[model samples]
Target: MPQDDPRDASLAVKFSPPQTWTAESVDGLATSGMFLAGIIMVTRNRILAWPSLILGVNSWINQHPLRTKEGGTPPVGNLALAFFALIASYLPLFLKATAEPAGATETQTPLSFST
Candidate 1:
């Protein structure tokens, strides 16, 4: 289904909702719903299925951890560690989505971490 839609373009632009929201909106809802469902499933010890689903959801959030000074006032490292775990857990899915295909036209884009 994802392969059918044009990359970076919303499916909503070309179609109207049939007694409900449009396809892109529907896809968005489905993605959100699946993510929540996957989280719930993971918490219940359903690792096999929820891991993949949660990865897609985590990529949607893409939040970065804020590191803090050591031996200062706050436990920023712990917070950052938590954030890293959250991001790491979903990294596989993000990489899969962004990875280039073999023999396909590859774009060399650099990602900036210092902001």
Candidate 2:
């Protein structure tokens, strides 16, 4: 019979899954989604941007430790990054909402110009 090597046990433990998702992983996915949304927004494609923004928001929400139920505290760095990505994903929409329309002209013109 072959004896079990302690080293093999350690190797097996190392290869085992943590069985829990980490905030960093979620944050990374959120960041990627935010980037994709930004790129699509740049092209003025609302259809694509909406889905990307939703993906980023979903990922950011998942970064909370409560979502994992794995007894691990949320990583602050990851939380911050994910929150930033979530906000960024909606930035274009906010800007568009606040922006003047292309056909809009200033109502208050110089008196000389009004004449």
Candidate 3:
């Protein structure tokens, strides 16, 4: 005989919740931002500095050290680095003398800090 509805059985089928953006994605964003910031800092692309700083702050705000895979602490250092990079990117502009880039004209000079 075919059991139309096997309610008598002790087992029942279960379904997992659907996946969505989770903790790992946030971590990736944070790391990528840090790396990109480092690259921009090196390349002298000062205009792109703000995005990384935003990413760092966002990641820090969403940090969940307790729930992280390794249970590591929040990424305060990453944010700090981002902040530093932003400052470094803009540092030259505020100075009195500057070193022009390779592509700059002979007369063009970049900012340089003075005592």
Give the winner by TM-score: 3
What TM-scores do the predictions have? 0.23, 0.33, 0.57
User: What are the per-residue Cα lDDT tens digits for candidate 2 across 39-106?
Assistant: 66455555555556566556656655534555544444444444454556556667747678899887
Task: Evaluate model 3: give its TM-score.
Answer: 0.57
lDDT score at residue 98, model 2, on the 0-100 scale: 65
Model 1 pairs whose backbones collide: none
Instruction: Name model 3 segments beyond 4 Å from true.
Output: 1-26, 69-73, 98-115
Stretch of 10 with least lDDT, candidate 2: 17-26
User: Model 3 misses residue 72 by how many Å?
Assistant: 2.5
lDDT of 3 by residue, 39-85 (tens): 77897678778888998898889786445655554679789888888
What is the alpha-carbon lDDT of model 1 when measured against the actual structure? 0.43
**Per-model lDDT:** 0.43, 0.55, 0.75
In Å, residue 88's CA in model 1 sits off its true spot by 0.4
Residue 59, candidate 1: C-alpha displacement in angstroms: 25
Q: Which stretches of candidate 1 lie over 4 Å from their true place?
A: 1-73, 97-115
Task: Put down candidate 1 lDDT per residue, 12-81, tens digits, no spaces.
Answer: 4765435422112223433453454445444533333344454444544542222222333222333333
Clashes of each: 0, 0, 5
RMSD of model 2 against the true structure: 10.8
Instruction: Give me the displacement of residue 34 in model 2, in angstroms.
Output: 1.1
